[model samples]
Each structure stands twice: as structure tokens, then as C-alpha cells.
Target chain A: MSQSDYDYLCDFLKERSGLALAPDKEYLVDNRLLPVARRHGRKTVAELIQMLKGPDSGHLKVEVTEAMMNNESYFFRDRVPFDRLGDTVLPDLLRTRALRKKIRIWCAAASTGQEPYSIAMQLDQRAELGGWRVEIAATDISGDAIERAKAGLYSQFEVQRGLPIQMLMQHFEEVAGQWRIVERLRNRVDFQTINLLTDFSRLGQFDVVFLRNVLIYFDRDTKLDVLARVRESLAPDGYLLLGAAETMVGLGDLFKMVPETRALYRPNVAPKKPELALVPGGARVA
Target chain B: MKRCLIIDDSSVIRKVARRIFEGFGFTISEAADGRQALDACVTEMPEAILLDWNMPVMDGYEFLRALRAMPGGDRPKVVFCTTENDLAHIARAMHAGADEYIMKPFDKEIVEAKLQEVGLI
Candidate 1:
């Protein structure tokens, strides 16, 4: 792939999803999208690009983007955030919301259902949450991944990664060698196909949000815009978790890292400033 | 030290598993087959046994059944670490008294997660 082609592809992805393809990602584009190109019957990547440019190629375009956007994730991808969630975050939220006995958790970029399902299992494990309603709302940029997330089925190897054996037995039932999350827990989450670049007010406010690992795909400006929109829907006292590798340190303090915690943040209350205004619903969907 | 038994035919697997289990604060023991594993159990029972499916003398299934039949055998957590993915095999293992299953080609995190599942760590 040429530099121009990579640039064009990056622009294309940015317009559809808020994903920014860095210039150094030509190798990644080659490795991840070559199979998509082959499936589309293109002899070479150049031909694939040309076909993507053809009239009424919207379907092909969506397929190609979805192919490239299938990021890798596992149940409780990192242990610390989840530990904090079960140990501190949820407990505090439960106490604060005890009057209403309601809590809403949003898992942005909930790939393959692992993250949201993991959240559900944790909430159910707490006997204190017996009568409380803890709603987990999960969304992904890809529709196919959202459907898979809704199904809550996982392969043997997939279940093995980061999933505790007892939790697997308690929350999932094995069917035809693959594990399926129990209906009781699987039904607790509401899955949606949402582009982070779009209006999320329709989803309403969240008491807790897990926006882990998805910010890296976007450029700096896009990250700021997404965080602003997240703030719109985030409760003032709500907690947010980013991936361990990710931070909001230089993002103008939209999220303030809580003391003695990694990736756990509280929304930094800032006066509405005109300079930070990012147009909500920035990109048009294909 | 938390005692753990690594029962497998492959020396490499045993060595690798020993390292992971040891890192989790376990004093490791190895057994070449189910027969040897049973003899080792008789000598000193471990808190957890990471058993592989296929072996020369006695396979994991037979060993699980025999182990379950032993006095106080059910006390230890038996986790099947194998490449097998068939439903029948899993059902057989569960019926034979296996506590959990972790697929092969795993690393330290996965091993630690499994031990955490069985409440060992």
C-alpha cells in the first residue's frame, strides 16, 4: 500500500468511525485487512482500494471498516481495574445510590461481550446487590461484535483468558464445547451499535462508565470530543475507568484520576469554555 | 508453601507449569502419569493438581476417577489442563470429579486466574 492509499483509508475510517489510522500503521492495515480484501475477490490491495471506490460500494466499505475495527479483548483484560471495580467502585456506588437502589454502567467499545459480561458477573456476585437494579449498557462501533456480545458465547480459549474458573462455572454453561453465559446474567446487559462520534444523549446518564482501550484508535482532537460527549452522559459523582495503558493526563483535565488508583477517574468539573467546544455527533455514519 | 502437583507426560509442560505455580507461592511436585500421580498423592497430597488429559500409564480421566475414589481425594482441587475441547470429554471429566479446566498453551496470567478460580490464590 502506498502512502497516499493509507492516507485515503485513514480519512475514510475517520469519517465513518472516529478511528484515526496513524501513518505507521501500514503493516497493520496490510495484515488485518488483507483477508477482508481476499474475501471481496480482489487480486491485490490496490484492486481492493479501487473496488472500495466504486459506485454503491457502501456495503463493501462498511464490511472493510468492520473488519479492521475488530480489536482484540478478553474477560477482565487487566486485573486491577476489575479488582477496583468490585472492591471499591461498585461498593461506593451502591452506598451512594442506596436510596434509589439503581446504578447504570456503560461499557464503551465492549468487544465480544467479555467486558460487559464481566461487569454483570461482578454485580451479581455481591449479595448486597440482591434487590438493587444494576443496568449494564454496552456499545461497540461494529454491529457484528455487538451481536456476538449479545449472544454471550465464548470459545474454550476465549473463556480461559482472564476468566476465573469458578465464575465460568457459575455464570456460564458449556454447550457443544463452547461456553455460553447464563441467561440470568446475559439478560442484564443492553447492547447497542453506537459510534462514539455520534450523539449519546439518547442513552441517557450513566453512573459508571468503562471506556477502556478504545481511545488509542482516535487522534487527540477526536479523543477530546469523545470525552466531552461522555461527560454529557456521565453522572457528576460517577466513576470512569480507562485502560491501564491509557490516561487523561494531558487531555485538559476532563477526567481526574482518583487518588491511589490506576485508570479510575472522577469527572473534573470545569466551567463551559468556548475554546473546548467540540461539535457533538461529529461524523456521518455510512 | 502452597503445595501443587503437575501431572503430565510432557516434561516441558511440567517445567513451565511448575514455574507459574511456584510464582503463585506453591511448592511444586511432578508426576509422569496417573499411576505415579496416585502414588505421589498417597505420599503427600497437594492442595491443587494441574492434570493433563493424555499420558502413558494412566490418562487424566482414569486418574480423576481413581483419585475421587481415594480417601480424602475429593479434598484437593483438580483442574484439567489439556488441549481437548470436546463436550463429551468435559462431561466425562466433570463426572470423574474434576473441579475446573484450563486449556493448554497458557501463560502465567491464565494459570494465576485458574488458581484464583479454585480459590487457591
Candidate 2:
């Protein structure tokens, strides 16, 4: 690929998906776009870039953007957050939302549904959540990913990654030599194709939002913009989970880190005093 | 050192699992079948056990039951590593007191993840 075409793709991806491709990442562009070029009957990535620059490249642009976007995912990708979901996060939400008897969770960049499905399985294990309405809204920028996630099917290799065998046996059934997540768990998640760069207010307020691992691609401004929008879509007491390496530093005052937690944050509101519990004939304790 | 017993009929799998677990600082021991594994356990109980389902002398389920019945046997974190992918086999393994399970043809990453899940690494 030529310098000019590389520059064009870098800018295009940045504008469309908030993917800040560095100048030195021309090799990444070639590696990802070459298969797209072949699929489009183009001789080389240069030809694909030329077509991408054409007047009627609207659909082609979407394809290119998605091809460049990383879709890496696995069951319970990071174990800590899931553990926290059961031990602390969900327990807190259960107490806070007991009267409402409803909990909404958004997997903002739910590549192929593992994160959301993992969350669903975790929620199922919580006996206290019985009779409560739970909605897991999982969305990805790639329609292909959303469709695959909706199918709930996975390869042998995919199922083995970070998935506990008990959960796999309990939740997924073998279908045509591949593992398919059971219909009950599949129906728990509502998958959709959504771009984080665009407005997602239609997703409504969520008690918890998992915006993990996808923010590393964005520049400073895009991160700030997306974080602000996420803050808007979250409930006042809702929690936002970011990637292990990602943070809210220098992104302005949209969120504050939840005390004694990593990569977990709540809205940037004034701290609420802890509720003290009192026992009969005993002193109050926090 | 954190001791782990690798029980598999296949020497290749045992070697591979040894290499991976060794890198994670586990002192590894090998056993060919479930009977041998149970005897090894009676001598000195390991902190963790990587068990295989279909062995010639004694299968994983029988061995698991025997081990759990023995004193200090329930202390080891038993992880079943086998080719058996069906629900019945998996459910039985868990029911027999196996802490975790892994499908066969596991690589370093999968082993690492499973070990991490069981808190070995």
C-alpha cells in the first residue's frame, strides 16, 4: 500500500470507529485489508483503497472499518471482573435495586457475546436474583459479530478459552460439531449492531455497563466523547467497567473509581456515606 | 514447591502438561493410570491433580471416588483433563468432586487459564 492510501485508511478508521491507527501501522492495514481486497475481487490492498476513495464507497467503507476493528474475545476474558460481579458488584446492585426488581447490563463492545453470556451465567448463579427482570443488552460495531453472537455458537477452540468446563457443560450444547450456548441463556441477551462513536441513548439507562478493552483504540478526544456519552446512558449509581489498562485519567470528570476496586467506577457524584447496620442490644457497624 | 500430579495414559500429554506446569513453578509428578495415581496419592497427597478420564487400570471417576474417600484426598484441587466433551461425562466429573475440567488437545494458554481458574498459578 502507498503512503497516501495508508494515510487515507488511518483517517477513515479514526473518523468511523474511533480507531487511532498510528502511522507505523501500515503493516496492520495491509494484513487486515488484503483479505477484504480478495473478497471484493480487487488485485491488491491498493485497489481496495482506491475503491474506498470512490464516490459510492459507503458500503465499502463500513466493511473496511469493521475489518480493521479488532474483534478478539473469549469466555470470561478476565476472571477478576467476573468474580467481582458475583462477590461484590451484583450483591451491591441487588441491595440497591431490590425494590425495582430489575437490572439492566450493557456490554458496549460485546464482540461475539462471550462477555454478555458470561455475565448471564453469573447472574443465573445468583439465587437472590430470582423473580427479578434482567436484561443484558450486548452490542458491537460489526454486524457480523452481532449475528455470530446471536447464534451463540462457538468452535472447540473458542469454547476452551477462559471458560470453566462446568459452565460450558451447563450452558452450551453441541450442535453440528460446534458448541452452541443454550437457548435459555441466548434469549437472556439482546444482541444488536451499534457503533460507540454514534449516539446510544436509545439503549436507555443501564445499572452496569461493560466498556472493557475497546477504548484503547481511541484518541484522547474520542475517549472523552465516548466516556461522556456512556456516563449519560448509565444510571446515577451505575457502574462502568473499563479494560485493565484503560483508565479515566485525563478524560475529565465523567466517572470516579469505586473504592477498593480496579477498573470499576461509578458516576462522578458526591460520595455517599456508608449505611450503618445496627443489631438489637448492639452497637452500629458499617 | 506447589506439587501437581499429571495422570494420563499418554506420555506425550503428561510431558506437555509437565512442561507448562513447571513453567508456572509446579513440582510435577507423572502417573500412567488411575490406580497408580491413587497409590501415588496415598504415599503423598499433591496440592493439585491433573486427571484423565479413560485409563486402562482404573477410570477417572472410580479413582476420584476412591481418592475422596481417603483421608487428605479432598485437599487436592482435582482438574479433569480428558477427550470426553459430552455433558454426562463433565457432570459426572464435577459430581465426583473434581474442581475443574479441561478438554483434550489443550495448549499452554488453555492450561494456564484453567490453572489460573483453579488458583494454581
**Highest-scoring model, lDDT:** 2
What TM-score does each of the candidates earn?
0.84, 0.91
Q: What i-RMS does each candidate reach, in Å?
A: 2.8, 1.1
lDDT of 2 by residue, B7-88 (tens): 9999999998999899999999999999999999999999999999999999888999999999998899999999987778
- Please give the DockQ score of every candidate, comma-separated: 0.44, 0.60
Clash pairs, candidate 1, are none
Distance from true location, Cα of A79 in model 1, Å: 2.0
lDDT, residue B111, candidate 1: 79
lDDT of 1 at B13: 97
Give the candidate number with the greatest DockQ: 2
- Candidate 2 TM-score on chain B: 0.97
Task: Report the C-alpha lDDT of model 1 over A82-119, residue by residue, as the tens digit.
Answer: 99898889879978999999999999889888999998
Give lDDT per model, in order. Answer: 0.84, 0.87
